[model samples]
Target chain A: MAKKNGLDGYCVPFFDDGNKSKFSLASIDPSSKPFSTGSKETDRERLAEIGVLLDAQQERLHAQRVQRVLLVLQGMDTSGKDGTIRAVFHEVDPLGLRIVPFKAPTPIELAHDFLWRVHAQAPAAGELTIFNRSHYEDVLVPYVLGSLDKEERIRRYGHIRDFERMLAESGTTIVKCMLYISKDEQRERLQARIDDPTKHWKFDVSDLDARKLWNKYQVAYEEALAATSTEYAPWYVIPADSKTHRNVMVGELLLRTFESLKLEFPPAKESLKGVIVE
Target chain B: MAKKNGLDGYCVPFFDDGNKSKFSLASIDPSSKPFSTGSKETDRERLAEIGVLLDAQQERLHAQRVQRVLLVLQGMDTSGKDGTIRAVFHEVDPLGLRIVPFKAPTPIELAHDFLWRVHAQAPAAGELTIFNRSHYEDVLVPYVLGSLDKEERIRRYGHIRDFERMLAESGTTIVKCMLYISKDEQRERLQARIDDPTKHWKFDVSDLDARKLWNKYQVAYEEALAATSTEYAPWYVIPADSKTHRNVMVGELLLRTFESLKLEFPPAKESLKGVIVE
Candidate 1:
């Protein structure tokens, strides 16, 4: 609820509206560089600058030991989630950052509710955490695979809305990004991996099967993002066709979010002023 | 076991040695510059170089997805554990590093065995985790406060040995460092914190009480390190009075530990040979 203004233009419309059919993934272009600085080199430099600022802010957050930050990244194959993390956080200290990549659930994870494991990894006080893929996977994956019915998916989305609301109320700042890429882009990326034997370990043939259901996945994403996007945990659709652009946009968004917190180091201890080290 | 030799001069002898009296905290000089590059400026430069090397090794470990690395840091107040983590891991990818700081136990944690909470935070495969303070706290605190009997302390040490051996056998590389700062050094550090009012948030008057019992804490540390140091899990005594020297030594030690693993990117996948995107 503490989110800054005008970001709503990039947000998926909140689901509070009774007629829920207005939002569409096709409305946004995946190749647009709206957040770019017009020069790739300039954008890279700007991102590095933001990284420095972000690090200072993060240290203040840690020193203050107050708020928590959670960034959730959800994207299709080859959407550059990992690359974005490596680039945007390249300059941030590893001491205060926690990156959790959610993979297919184990038997025990599946035994519990979808949110159980996710809640376990939520950022602690003064911590910054990222989920490479997150609870949204529950809505998107099962829906795309046709294992989840419409009403059940809706119910889960409601649960997510409630969950994020609770986190916000309890002093957490949340940001969710849905990495949007064109089907054509996916084809090129997947084929490149297939052609490069060295990259094969990162590719799975099943990805091709997922590509076959491209439209269905997009629809699933559109619905989930729309329903779960709230003032407390708004979802932003990121244009991720260009890796550098994607990294810059994500970094910029995160810097803005952190600055919104207005973090400062705790006031110097009055008692220690003028005291000397031995 | 993959640890390099000549480094053994800094290592506390493995507890398997029956007689632990030879390892004494008083024997090590906290201000020693054994790993320093002969000049403060040169030592800083060396530390930066090691950061880059550590980053590369960490990436390979992540790509291999086979082994885990755990670094345990224990030191008296202001001994520079946090500073070392920031400076040494400055270049590492945030995605591959996990820093877990163990604090005083919560009600739930107290109900379980001391190692229970620690076991849950151990590094996963392909992870390089640093415990800002660790299970060693369990040993040191109770002994220093006279809450745990000597026999119970010895038993806890056995539990740690068994637990760590299992981690190593299951593919974890463990390194523990006890940052050894002389009581005089601690007094200076504590006084500096007290004098700087901005740092008051980090200081507790109770810290003065701990300083009052400095000798007792040192003896407790000596016993615990001697008891828990093992072939699979070694404890190194880091001379930590000079911040630059401490950072350099820890950086060098970690880089060496990572290099000994011989980690490499997995062999290029053969199945995608000649395949093309689209």
Candidate 2:
């Protein structure tokens, strides 16, 4: 699926056996618009087209009731994870799509294995599920706060890879995207929110603390992505500095993935071939 | 809320202490468009206007995070429960909206009381939830199938009323809607699905059996609506034969309900007043 429109260029190389030195987060420019048509009008037109096609594809997914699709989104604050979902899925039937947002783990969540809460929300048969912020949080937040040691972080990465492999082997298709944005872009977004008091509800004073550790989070993401981007659950680096480009790229990638599934409405029921409703 | 646009005319009268004879489902016309502006184009325009307003209202509800809202939709097969949600919520932010669809119960759901599964899906503070089909099914399906005797059915209605009242007292505002369609409309809709091979996935031969018992189901609905409609959670009958009219009326009713809440974005956080992201 990634081969379409050179999307493969954005996919992280599949993790090798402890040879994770080939990938570097800094090498990718978040502002690049390789998938953009260079015209906002044209890009939006494409996005609308993708929305209609996605709506149709999702209907087939819901009809067949066989395979499951999961999309995991990870990004820094103000990176447009929410925006991407709204734009890309604007036309999909809300009934067929389930969006699960993971907030800070509660005491009960913290009491169990990290995957315990996550596994409970996995997509059912013929379902398309989105994980706004997912199990990756377990690795990202603690490591940046110096709560998780290097050895334990490495072990957690192994656990994630194994968990994802099990899901992929169980009739589920998985795709992960990391919405990449530049520091300067985030500054503008954060400042804009602060400028508008109405948007203050979406901002937090502690978000600045995360900004202070931006470099550390980037390194953590790099390590996690390098260790866990396997053949079954690859991560794509989305250039999200351009909202239009980010939405279009993600839509195109998903369109390609769905097309590969070769989904169709189940064959007409013979029992009702000529039966009339009375 | 129902006072606006004379929507009160469509509301099932509140169930008095024990006098439930004021409401009758058969008195309402399935094809009427009392809310329509006499043109399909105008009705659609109004629906679009309501959609935008609903989007803004939902955002405020989310920002406030102090109140909860639940919309319960009950309907027979092909009554447009799915269609109404798709049309009315098209513009609302998917992040703030949760759509829960209830299908037939599994062994586990049937093992416990019916409300157990529903209570688990109730809206949390700062949420707007829609139950595509709800516990009303416990009454409608069983009564129509002759498995539930009248005495037990009356007990169940009281149980629903008390449960909803408790939710209302706890800060959740609830609105229930029944999509009313004519039996002839159902025949046409079912036949249309049969004529289109791709739609066979949506058609079940059992749906014809339900249609054969249409009168019984209506009686059950009439009794349920009369017994359960109350000040805390009212039931509104939506004439759904005209798809455009059905969408518009539902939109108008919900818009009025939301406006009654006088929802506004929560006051800007004092802590974020002058703090700048660094």
Candidate 3:
């Protein structure tokens, strides 16, 4: 399990037919810093250390070329999804990491099943892929917008679980994280962007419309996470109010996950041990 | 034109119906270092400087989201394409750079016209894409292996020029580089890889077969470059016997291309100027 820094406490309980009521999003405080080392400086130091280790691990993963890793990040607007990616992956080899930002579905995309576009971008062997926002949006967004009924939402959840299980059984190691943040935190972050006129390109009035439905969205996330969290693809509730804490905890969680794989470089080639080139 | 460091001399003369014999690959010395700063330390310092500038330029490119940039790299197997990418792009934002390596075409890729797979990977607006080994391989490899006749090769070259012209007209800024390395340099590099057992994953005895056909490949590259270099997409011969020199020259060439685009950040949105989050 390679558990350290009490990361186990953050794992959402695995879903089962009879355990639906055992997990609640409201039970976890978004502002808590369970994994922090009590100071911002120390937390950043820990992050840098983890970054180096992740770079080495990723190189080995690329060398082995047999397994894949997928990190799925889900959060509300201004909850720091983009910031977390930039900071946490700052030290990873750019050659080995592929970041796919899934935007609103296009006309062609809407014509197909929700997972059609997503399946095409799944990590190939020896690749580490990050989904800035992923197929989870299919369940969360439409349900919150009243376009999906409960019966249909449950079926989509079943589809997601089966699809993810297939990916895991084949060789992918999946980790899903919901970056939980307080409503007050979102308000301040949005206001900061507004204050900086140069950053306006990243802002839109529609973002506020989503914020207005914050509570409803949270409810949607709770249901979706509960229904989809399984032994193969588990979800973690990341307390993300503090940016430094968020980056460190996510890095720690990923480092531990990679460690569990026990990745090693491929055995040295016996045939090439003493060969000479002309 | 943002030219500095005598870069103009390295440009492959623009192709035309009549200047067929004006440019020769043999004329350029692979060991030359016109861009070098005399010492490896100073060259590295200069590379670090360009890396920072490149990072800023790429940030603006991603922010503006109107124009695209594509860098195509081609060379013999051990001419350091992978190493050059790692060194030159070390400081650029990983999110902004997409490195697409073209391996030997798969059966599916072979089923289509040569450009079919390549056109799909063209840089989208606001992207900076690098093709590790590109469509140029179609002309180089097959010609060297006697799989394609001269007439067909000429036709493919025309097809490539038209394809690139369309991409340029549609707002892609293209820069291509052929990493020029002497045969002795390649021999040393291949031998080093063979001697290190851990590096065998990147080596193949078949690479020696290609080395034996080096002269044929050089002639093929000469014909392809002379026929395809154009006003829109230009190719440069990068003398690459010294790794630091190759990275610096390539970096300098790309920096100049990006500078020519005169990219700027999108203007601040008046709508978001004074709004406050509720």
Candidate 4:
């Protein structure tokens, strides 16, 4: 079967009203099942090949002085943003990668515009900045909490889109992904946390309240993807039910995005007359 | 052959002259050799021990509860901060470590107080944040360049100490290291960079201009250290002539500091009775 946009035929179908209830992921996404049960040897071999390709592409990227990448991952708690980043950039040089995890804003942050804190964290050229949760929290948390009026929420949506566009204009390639997990999966994970004393620290009783608003969050995510997805910064809905599939898909997507960038190391400064890489 | 506060015995006699430079850099401080040419194997073995110790400490830090570690590295260009971090943390779990490299502030950063940018990068509990260059740069860079008057520089000195104190109060264990490299060694390294094309990318011609004021910077560093070093965030003057020695010392110091915390895994919320580590 021909893959959809080279996504191993696992592309998220365009949101449709008729499919709203059909969005349930009771089983693994059919499109991703191909490599799910593949032999361990075959998987290892594929990973090794990808690693070599990634190394060459990263080398070229450092040399060519290409645009930086801004990867924004948004999802509900335990939706696998951290795990995805770990699996995706497992082999990448830490020097070239930056992860910014935004927590509740401090007093100083509250005094400024929502974007102020985020603007300071943008990656420089020729780097990758991954946001475990980004400026979207400004909208997501506020929207879910209903702290902002509908009009105010709508206004902020445009502001976010414009801000992302500005980042792109300044030579950042933005890839935003939302790791979507079903309520059933979240319940199972949270139950695992409650059942295992080793995971107790991760459970805050308040989380169950959020779990009750699962349908609300699903609608919010759909709205977020529809509103903020732009040519400069597109959104990808990642099925995060299966950790292995999520890991492999995120890695493959990153490899594909980086491959598309024609990067090369900048020429050596003329001030050095004798330096060589070898 | 008694070690003084874990420093080499060379430090005891020098305590009387606390005003005297702690640095033994020949070209930079003109008093002692930074490299130990003898007992290389002992140093290497010690470094391996330190590496193992540090790994254990870091694991405990991660498990005990997330604690933030802010490691500040300051020195003139080619002083080996980048190289030191690479060697010391090469095997560290990337999930728990962050290296923040500071440069000239962007326009937005400049608009805010200088500390704003630095504050944003502070690690959450349970992370090791390495500052290749940190807020100290505000004082070091400005002092060395003579861009700030004495009054302003002194003011910045107090500000930095306070900022660090606040960071420490907020559960961050701060370890600051100054890589003391001699002028002759720096010249050799600079020349090597000029001689090798691969290393050419790191060389900046302006380093020589800074070399001319090397002594002035040394005086500045001494003053800054004296003014700022405290019981909580003491400065480690590392002998950096040998790359191996420098890395080993840093690794040992970090390992020692983290071990002193006596971290334990935060008890998990749920029982992990059935889970397997593998």
Query: Model-by-model lDDT, in order?
Result: 0.86, 0.91, 0.89, 0.70
Candidate 3's C-alpha runs over 4 A off are: A1-6, B1-6
Q: Whose DockQ is greatest here?
A: 2
Off by over 4 Å in 4: A1-5, A8-37, A40-66, A104-116, A138-156, A274-278, B1-5, B8-67, B93-95, B104-124, B138-170, B215-223, B268-278
**How is the predicted docking of candidate 3 categorized under the CAPRI scheme?**
medium
Error in Å for residue B229 of model 2: 0.1
- Cand. 4 Cα-lDDT: 0.70
Candidate 3 — which pairs collide? none
Question: 3 or 4, which is superior by lDDT?
Answer: 3
Off by over 4 Å in 2: A1-5, A16-19, B1-5, B17-19
Candidate 2 structure quality by residue, lDDT tens digits, A214-244: 9999999998898888888889999999999
Classify candidate 4 by CAPRI docking class.
acceptable
Native contacts recovered by model 1: 0.73
| Docking quality (DockQ) for each candidate | 0.57, 0.73, 0.67, 0.29
Best by TM-score: 2
**Cα displacement (Å) at residue B111, model 3:** 1.0
Per prediction, the TM-score for chain B is: 0.97, 0.97, 0.97, 0.85
In candidate 4 the C-alpha lDDT for residue B125 amounts to 73
The candidate, 1 or 2, that scores higher on DockQ is: 2
